[model samples]
Target: MMNRRYVPDLPEQNALSEANFLRLEKLLGGLKNSHYDFQWFGRNNEPVQVHAEIIERFKFTSTVNLIKQNSALPKPMDRVQLTIRMYHDARMAEVVTWDSGRQLSGVYPYPNDRMYQIDEKAQANVFLGEWLAHLLRHGVAEREWTPS
Candidate 1:
């Protein structure tokens, strides 16, 4: 592996990203307003709320914000907040910012400044996929529920 070069697996990334678009749509499609609230009893039957909002919209793209509210998970996981850009034209969504952090890069130099994983971008997307799937799997849409 001395001479091996890093290459972005565009195909795999594309597939996961594309699938995430669908997952997002499934999560956000039926929302009656710009903001949506939901609840899911995950992990020890504790109530975890999810907040989703359409933060921006344009001709062929939209920005969405997702956050876990009242989560019982540990740090970072419990603080999962993301602003995703949905490319309607291309039919996929990618995380633009995580936890309000800097713009996510597709690849990072190993042992870099932030101690991030090499495939941070891809991992973000995958994390999003799992989050969305969890929302779809267990979330119950709230029409007028308030966080408590």
Candidate 2:
């Protein structure tokens, strides 16, 4: 799965890249029903484990035109916008506000309040795995993802 970091710059691609989106479309189109295991640590410092099955995977167009698109409105929000064609399966991807470096947000699932409570490294790993699994489920190839 191509990590969000490795995804081509969205502005450069305009709306969405057909090649990458098509890759995902073809991959998910083949799957019937399959549960993929994912693991992570919790805010209480415990392990979070779950299995999400592949129901359907497809591409959708979304945008975060400005930094404030991430802002929580009432409060300052820190986040990163991953522009790509994504899926809507059993596990719904959510907006996660985390403190990767300076307080930042991401298009995964996590909250800011507990950001300090969870094991950052472990959670990051788990998040990465889930992100990768989502990509692989859709047949997207893996690529090195680095923060900008």
Candidate 3:
């Protein structure tokens, strides 16, 4: 169970997030069926296969973590995680990245950069697609993360 302090308690927001979660679940389910895989090149130029799988889904949020293929990395790197935070307002939903057991920045994908807002109109599928792509592209080049 997650700590109450970490879980948002807004009822309406939770509903919105739930809807987003459903959409995300559908999206990821499709990806899994298609056998879509993301590749991240390590500092040593070795390729790390990244697989997306849903770990948990709640009323107000959902979690999708990337599993490193062949157990090529350690705990956190072995699984890059993200959370979807639902909102009641027009902003809809927000996706937050987590690493090393800490939230890097809410709704901001890039690490070590100024935190910015995700597009308010973006749906869960699009948000996730872009985020995964960003991870593959910048995570290695800018974040100095090597596949373990």
Tens digits of lDDT, candidate 1, 1-148: 3855568899998999899999988778733357888898866888888888888888889898998866577765676689999998899899999888999988888889999888888889989998899889888988642223
lDDT of 2 at 70: 21
How much is 103 displaced in model 1, in angstroms?
0.5
| TM-score list, all predictions | 0.88, 0.22, 0.33
Candidate 3 on 1-148: residue-level lDDT in tens?
A: 8733223235744455555555544434422332234566765676766555444545544345544442556654565445544333332444554332444332334232444334222333354556554554444321212222
Off by over 4 Å in 2: 1-115, 139-148
The per-model lDDT (C-alpha) reads: 0.83, 0.32, 0.45
lDDT-sorted candidate list, best first: 1, 3, 2
True lDDT of residue 69, candidate 1: 67
RMSD of each: 3.4, 15.8, 12.6
Candidate 2, position 55, lDDT: 33
Give the best candidate by TM-score: 1
Number of backbone clashes in candidate 3: 0
What is candidate 2's TM-score against the reference?
0.22
List the pairs of residues colliding in candidate 2. Answer: 78-104, 78-105, 79-104, 79-105, 80-105
Q: Provide the clash count, candidate 1.
A: 0
Q: How accurate is candidate 2 locally (lDDT)?
A: 0.32
